[model samples]
Target: MAGGRQISENKKGLPRRWRFMHGAYFYSVPPGQECMWDGKKTFHLGRGLPEAFRKWAARMEQPGKIHTVSDLLERYLLEVIPKKAPKTQIENARHVRSLMAAFGSAHLYEIRPRDIYRYVDARSAKTAARREIEVLSHAFTKAIEWGLIDNHPFKGQIRLEGETPRDRYVEDWEVIEALSLSAPQKRGRRQGPAGLYQAEAPDRPFTWGYASPAAGCEFPGRWHSGAVS
Candidate 1:
């Protein structure tokens, strides 16, 4: 369901009114509802509109006040949690990037489950979808506090399972393969992601961004430490 926000009025010089979609709602004040200036409105996008979004539409439309998603997040960051922790800020930045990177920076009022899923899927492999979506939910929670918007889209939604953290340790071959592709070095007889070895450049940072169980360069396996590639 796409929630489209609209400014309804016969205001002169207006570009026929603006319409924007979020999810499961189509907002628009039928012409003549404009009291002084064009007023914005939100409404259910489909028959099976979520109760939450329906309620949101009712409140926002009964007294039309539309805000963009980014606008809401900004208010949430500074105005709502002025004293937010440094770690939290960092996480927010990371998660927010995943969201925007998944979806373009459109009017925030237009995000939908589709966009949300896209975000989750895009970063699901790298970072668990649970934390990624959770962080986004926190942003919406803050928005609620600031009265910018209600209803966290992630609520009641299925998230990646929360089990004991899983390990994505790559194998010797896998590691060498990835490393070879990313940080290509003197390709030797070695193959797989394992051949991804760098000459002992104790001076250089670990050539690989993440670690694998290989060449002893990896944890517990660190063997010939003389800069095992």
Candidate 2:
């Protein structure tokens, strides 16, 4: 502070900036010695005046200027991915971990459109990869909302939409097959006995076989065959 005259307050009596930032909020240990909150915290400023403090702070305040892949990965998992189903979230977390293992230390700014495009292609080939891509896309979308990234790499990408077709639909031929009873013995309308079909007895399980086309079979033989009333 140099002990000079105290600067006057701003419009709201709050100084916009201070010379010596106070508070010893974090502790340090020897290198390679594990700290309880290592790799999961943001309190690493030390006693020396950093030459790149302004640049670093500016980047930190930037909407999505994460310096390492790990930072973005953690943020995406904790903030965005969990909003989906638990199964989906777990899968995305696994994919994100795999991606980081592949390139964890890479700087975020260093990742290019080509890199992301390659990622899309690679992740699109498998179910897990596709799900991971979806989650990654979601996180990137949020980053765009925060003014972090400019655009989504998965935009306009060709991928599966996860749908299964229904087989219940029957064509006209199928409906005819279902109602193929003979016309003479048909309980309902019969086309002059030509369309009449007789189902066999219940001797065998589901033994109701359709009558042969060449030689029509007897209908139960209990009364006049193929004769109504």
Candidate 3:
């Protein structure tokens, strides 16, 4: 009694439910069965895709289940968060906590796109809201895979407009000119040590610090203070 898109033939050249990325093979869980795989939305099957297919086939024979949005959140916090990168694990945990406050007690299928939009609109931090919704959307995706729900309510529909990136990034030529202007002055003060320091010294202080004696000079503080010439 599974719902949503039917399983189709693999036109992407790889096997059905299988994906290759960053030099590893991944198996997308069957809709409504992620709980069986300990809440992993996709199983990392290793670098060699062909051999990984056998592992995928064996895991596909078994299926598992879940209860509510909170149930999903718990499982994700327990099973999924530990597997992510250190920074991402912290971010996802915060996102999950925010989501739990809003949708924890609700049933998986009961969530709608409108509910998500309302959440987005109500949140004061648009960028943070967008990130939290991304986590929520991914949870719904896992819900569909685990067979907890037949359809994702807010997968691609909600758009939380975040702050734009600042346009005033420093140019490479500006950096080169700054370095050029500072170099001769440094050489004038300390001839031998300053001559050893290159234009790239300002970019990598710690590395250059151990590598060159000039790094011991007050150049680190002077450069950081934006004293060019």
Candidate 4:
């Protein structure tokens, strides 16, 4: 206890158990537990500090074992991607690659909401950017569950643009007209407007019409032919 400075001499009014040393306050626990105070009113050296101290000590011993964004992405790709559908795997892989290119060198804990927002802003496609952030958010959640990181940077921060649903209705005649203009391909039988309309309207009666009037109309002005107005 030679180097143990007394708390009474300090004007800050900290408890006697707390001692200031090397510009930080440390609380001394019974049975030889010394925990560093984060100066935010939280005591890390109090109850259950031994386990935390042990983890800290272990981390100190290794030093280079800190997980980075690239590491998390690699683990996610290896462990989680295989469980998803083939199409989903491809899509998620693309998103992860984009994320890795940006923050792969940064530590998982160092990434913040601003960095994610920057990435979102850099992308030209709003929907694709949203999807990329969504994938990154899921990966960060998995990283939390895996004990790689403590929190998600993108949680509650990502805002995707609203998608407007198409309300235009396609009349039967418009579908017929559009299909009539489409020439059949030489290699295979083409699905005409009637055939396409039939395929799209199997679940509902055609009287109510299809919600997407532009489905059969490839021409620029064809969508207006069946306008509800």
Most accurate candidate by lDDT: 3
Q: Across residues 1-229, which tens digit of lDDT does each residue of candidate 2 receive?
A: 6323221111111111212234211223234434433543333433222211322242233235565656676566545553545334434555766566534565544443333433433342445545455455455566566666675433333333342443455344224433443443343322223212222322211111123335543312111134343
Q: Which candidate number maximizes TM-score?
A: 3
Model 1 over residues 108-150: C-alpha lDDT tens digits? Answer: 4455444444343333253545555655556566555557655
Tell me the lDDT of candidate 4: 0.47
The residue pairs in collision within model 2 are 181-196, 181-197, 182-195, 182-196, 182-197, 183-195, 183-196, 184-193
Question: How many residue pairs collide in each prediction?
Answer: 26, 8, 7, 0
Candidate 3 lDDT over residue span 1-229, tens digit each: 2211111111122444567666566878877888877788888976543345445545554324566677787656554454555445556766777777667666676665555655555555767767777677667666666667876665444434444663565444335423533344444433322113223333421110111347443212111223433
lDDT of each: 0.38, 0.39, 0.54, 0.47
lDDT for 39 (candidate 3): 88
Kindly report which residue stretches of model 2 are placed more than 4 angstroms away from their true locations once superposed: 1-65, 109-125, 157-229
What's the TM-score of every candidate structure?
0.36, 0.36, 0.43, 0.42
Q: Model 1 lDDT vs. the true structure?
A: 0.38
Number of clashing residue pairs, candidate 3: 7
Q: Candidate 4 on 1-229: residue-level lDDT in tens?
A: 5223322222132223444454444445444232333333323432222232332333222223547777777666656654555445556666776666666667676665545544544455657666667677777777767777765654653334443443556434235333432232311222212112112222321111123347553211111123462
After superposition, which runs of candidate 1 have C-alpha atoms over 4 Å from their true positions?
A: 1-66, 80-82, 162-229
- lDDT (Cα, 0-100) at 204 in candidate 4: 21
TM-score of candidate 2 on Cα atoms, chains taken together: 0.36
Better of 1 and 4 by lDDT: 4
